[model samples]
Target: MAKEMQKTSMFIERNPGDCENGDICKNLDDDGRVKRTGTWVTASAHIITAVIGSGVLSLAWAIAQLGWVAGPAVLMAFSFITYFTSTLLADCYRAPDPVHGKRNYTYMDVVRAYLGGRKVQLCGLAQYVNLLGVTIGYTITASISMVAVKRSNCFHKHGHHVKCQTSNNPFMVIFACIQIVLSQIPNFHNLSWLSIIAAIMSFAYSSIGLGLSIAKVAGGEHARTTLTGVTVGVDVSGSEKIWRTFQAIGDIAFAYAYSTVLVEIQDTIKSSPPENKSMKRATTLGVSTTTIFYVLCGLVGYAAFGNEAPGNFLTGFGFYEPFWLIDFANICIAIHLIGAYQVFAQPLFGFI
Candidate 1:
């Protein structure tokens, strides 16, 4: 047993402090080292965190813009594309064994190793943009959720646009503060609990939002909307229609922009046993689950609000019903997004 423990220590990550949870290990490699510590569950959380973010809050709005038939069609297409691209990415984690079993540690490594041109720089640029966009999106969403809960008059009349008295900036600043402390924990493996919690919160709010929408629709609270979904409230003519339609497509595209972490999160899985299959499984499970959630949210939100759906479904789910449920839903959103920021940012931090 002592000899086995000693052998294991060679590969085990040396954490900053003793792990409080026997299984959860938060550690860092001082010299940009990747540790193989994550299980399939942990990898799934990271993937889920990457795939589902603040963009989900706008899916219903996207559906409203694209109409029902087109909206769902686009989502299904994106799902298939993301799944294929994800698997292709997982296969890139390692090189042919003849090359001394070399591995591509970051997404940039793969680009530089294989593409070897101006494309490397472009990949880096895109990665930074993705990281920045994801971080900003989560930070903003978290702040909005916090604001929805803190303010008393968040929900009032259905047709009335209720505004929160408190500034969202303060809440964002507070999130940053909390994040700085949380970010100190270095290892992705250590955040297993956090990832699990985020996943649960995601399911929680999605279920609540869907359930309420169904109830409202069944109770005749909402008018029957067309299959195409909602409207952008713009005159349908010339480039105006074309531009907005494309813009809505771009919005849906943003929802699935989770490719940034493919290599890094896959790096967390053990290279033995399941081998190349670890990330494939994670991608399939995570993306599949998120797609279901997205469809439900988009359908339910559009059903309730039709053409009137706002840009953010969470804040605009329903004002009058049980206001507390809205608050609860937002609370879940805020918590999930906080973890999401770390999941997306960790890869950037690793690469840099």
Candidate 2:
């Protein structure tokens, strides 16, 4: 009997997955880590939270620069490119064989598995640097949104003519404090709630922006818009127009810049349906959803403000009458960025 017990223990140690009666093994996944509870829905939430960031707020300005002809075209082009590359990246979540092979936990892990040596280090360096930049950008954007909220209220109480100037330092400090607390979250697997909240906030603000643009267009207030975008010498100087056009393209590209965190997001998905298959479906759903929002926001915003669209319609002081709605939209932007900051920052935190 003792010999049989010892053999059972050895079997359990050698094959953890086969240990049906063991609590520890039952709690763990095939990879010997804590079980992953994420589904494609949660994965889509994370992707949406990461993809539709503060960058979406600038799509109006992007479309304004490119105008009717190239604006929609560029948006669609980037959408396709992002979706295509993301599907390919999803397949790389597992090495050699996506389903049965060993898991690659992060983007850097994926790189290390497929292309070892110096390439891994290079990928890590680039990825972390990009993540750092994105976090910094989110910090600034969140502060700006917070400041916009305050300024919107001030303008409503005072007058639009009043400067209502407010310092971003205090807001920045507040945003930093919030991030410091949220940064305590251990990993992507534990961030589903935050991502879901952030995803909701993203939709709230985006929908508000779209609604506002539709209202503005319906009110019959039209600004000049050319098929080729802002006129060369009339609306802007030759050099200014060229630079603005390039910057607009950059903004559109940046709006689809969540690919950096794709592998990390994929790591949280369960392995039953296969991680790659789940990730691909989530990617398709998330990107398709965002593309629809992007097209609506960009085109409708341009139609509302024409070539004179502000960089960010919410904070750019484009609509002033419905001040409460504007304030709420800005607040939503701030809330969304709070979670987004972590989504991008966790990979860097894990690496460290």
Candidate 3:
């Protein structure tokens, strides 16, 4: 409360004669003007990096289970929802000038402003839990991608159980080490170049997946038909089917979930130009780019592997013709996940 009053008083005495320590008070302009300095393109890249992570790799499997019709529909719905909620986060950057004309640097701040202290605590809890899950998810995805890249063959006899003895622990430890260093970079704004690289990495792997699918189909080595029915409104049979469909929906939702870090990304976009619109533009571009990739990857992957699609697309769809591409895509995924870990972990670090 005292800190809030001091800030309020500082803004009030922003005038020349009101402050005895005029230099210090003036330096404490501490308004949106100074906070908003990031370039829109860079901000868009960060947001893109945040949205497109390991989730995209599994998107194909979800589509396969849900079939073409429902899969695309779910992806579109999440695209719209994620985009809308993200813009709402950008708008929360500056509360009404009367309250606090400064920028909100994190999602927790926004929740605290609108919902109060308890909600802020809940948001922090949720944020950390979400980050922890993302870290684990990324770790698992990276390990699987690496394992897939190194596999000599999958020609083992069925019903003859062979102990693969795979442990993702080493891979996870390597990334955890990377994050321990990257996370110390101090802030999101500093990651502009890295974010751009991560964004391009996302596009590269996604395009590779799509291109491989198309190539397989052209070579007559892939199936274009769905493993499950795609008829709209066709009622699924039994409780098991319904439950599986619901699980697919949850998967799609999880794929598009990035609201936890929206505010933090927005903080990097400048408000200098009073009516700063960079944040909204960044969110739009990021969501639009990811949605496009999601659609193409899902549709093409399902067509390539049919219902045989594995939960991890990189490992499931093995295009051995020019196998170097597989290695490149998996490497890119690992690189992208590193940046993604920083994106989520940075905000959680601040909250701590």
Candidate 4:
């Protein structure tokens, strides 16, 4: 019986594209689809791209308007707020079973589940509004920064804001549109390397500009007046007692305003495997990195200017000067923001 065993054996072999049920699995074959493998660095890069954008550049302006201590405090406060929102989403949201599986309920799903349909619609609309405002702000800031870099113009040449020239210069619109279009193209795979390079460029650029600002301020015979009065709009009027009280709360508002993305980030990481500790670790590192960077930029900008008022930091400190790196940073930021817009817009697109 042992000698005859090989004569009775039958073997079944499956091809690479075959399924266990003996079906040819064509579902994965050239369906205009691509798959990407993401490790910790890729995940971190994506999250960082979400968090750090055109907003960081405006930190100096916001903090200047609010106060010096208010800037870094805002960053820390926003970080925690975002973290808490993310945690809440992780605990409350649930996905349907695979047998009748639906795409997992996103943050919008949780909002709709808790708040109902009408509120969800309203919230979605509000998010679009926020996105629009954010986009416009970024585009304007980037274009202006581009001008400042290329023309060696003043950072805040109030008489000739760079955005004002766009109507006459068709090339600027063409370039901006091209950048926007490039951002919209789906090439999510293999972008981890691109993001890593961008992040490095961001750090290097900020470091050099910040260093120069610090040096000039240190050697200063104080070219600009050290700001004292809390200016409202363009007015240099002294801060009123009531306004000063309000200014104390300014950082909290700014911090919370930017905390909205935390929900999206939380949903993303929570979708990963339970055993994968790296997602959480990456998130923590990303938030910490952003916090440290913002704090350093804010503190240095404030100290160099010697003012508690936010605007004072920019002008009084002379630290917001046009550096070559700002141009590069703006482009990187625009690209990074395009990724973010894609992520945020996908759910809405699906619902529509």
Highest TM-score model number: 2
User: TM-score per candidate, in order?
Assistant: 0.83, 0.94, 0.83, 0.65
Rank list by TM-score: 2, 1, 3, 4
Question: Which prediction has more favorable lDDT, 2 or 3?
Answer: 2
For candidate 2, write residues 250-326 as lDDT tens digits: 99988898888999999898888999999999999999999999999999998998888899988888888688999
Candidate 2 RMSD to the correct structure: 4.8
Worst 10 residues of 4 by lDDT: 27-36
Q: What would the per-residue lDDT of candidate 4 be over residues 1-352, giving only the tens digit for each residue? A: 8635422221123355555563443222211121124555665665566566544544554555455455455667877876565444444434333222232235566567668768988887777666566555545544544443443234445433443332314435644675566454333433455556556644654565456547756876353222432355443444553465355345334433433443343333323443134455666677677777666665555555433424322212233445334445445544544445444344444455
lDDT of 1 by residue, 1-352 (tens): 9967644654564465535573434333322243466777788888787777656767777887778799899999999999999888777777654123466777888788778799999989999887988788789889988987765344454334655467899999999998898887665556777878888887888787778778877888765466655333442445555676788899878788778877777667765544358788888899999899889888787787777667876665454457778778889989999888888777777666
Clashing pairs in 2: none
Tens digits of per-residue lDDT for model 3, 125-202 = 888898888877877787777665555133232222443445667877877788788877856768887888888888
The global C-alpha lDDT for each of the candidates, from Candidate 1 onward, is 0.75, 0.89, 0.72, 0.48
lDDT of 3 at 56: 79
TM-score of 2: 0.94
Q: Indicate the worst ten consecutive residues by lDDT in candidate 1.
A: 26-35
State which candidate, 2 or 3, has the greater TM-score. Answer: 2
Winning candidate number (lDDT)? 2
